[model samples]
Target: MSHDILRRHLRDLIDAYNFAQWLKTLKGLIPNEFICKRWTSEPNGFIITPIDQIPGLNT
Candidate 1:
């Protein structure tokens, strides 16, 4: 892809990643019951809960 196109795609990816991180943070601020079930979904660079799990947190 051309540099301009690559840069635009990267910018969009970054925006999406940033939005996901913001959503995660927003979820943390809200009550568990009120939060969306999808809050646990992974962001590009954000790790909410690990695959191996953190014992009580993931359980």
Candidate 2:
């Protein structure tokens, strides 16, 4: 495998292994876990409406 592929794979695997070993050390968002991360990366222009704006969610 190419160096780039090996590097990325190794990074993700290492982070996963470390996170599992010390899960209690993580109190916030988990590393390599991406959702807002995806939204931040793409090229788009949609106002990130606050979750509080959802009429039913607040109810």
Candidate 3:
């Protein structure tokens, strides 16, 4: 019903849901994909900005 209550219920089933294991499996799929990208917005974090705004990234 509420955010906290929903999160608490999900937390109890973390193992049953295999959340961490599912993430690990997804991580392994990254390399299998043909096209992979790591575009960055600013110095610290990764966010996608318009090409015109981050023209420095243009190659």
User: Highest TM-score: which candidate?
Assistant: 1
RMSD of each: 11.4, 11.6, 11.2
Listed in order, each prediction's TM-score against the native is: 0.46, 0.38, 0.25
Clashing pairs in 3: none
- Please give me the total number of clashing residue pairs in predicted model 2: 0
Instruction: Give the TM-score comparing model 3 with the true structure, all chains together.
Output: 0.25
For residue 47, model 3's alpha carbon misses the true position, in angstroms, by 53
Off by over 4 Å in 3: 15-59
Error of 1 at 5 (Å): 0.3
Error of 1 at 6 (Å): 0.1
Task: Kindly report the root-mean-square deviation of model 3 from the true structure over all alpha carbons.
Answer: 11.2
Which model is ahead, 1 or 2, in terms of TM-score? Answer: 1
Q: How many clashes in candidate 3?
A: 0
1 against 3, candidate with superior lDDT: 1
lDDT of 3 by residue, 1-59 (tens): 99999999888788657866665766744422311222332424435333345435566
Off by over 4 Å in 2: 24-59
lDDT of 2 at 22: 66
Reference-based lDDT, residue 14, model 3: 83
Q: Give the alpha-carbon lDDT of every model.
A: 0.59, 0.59, 0.52
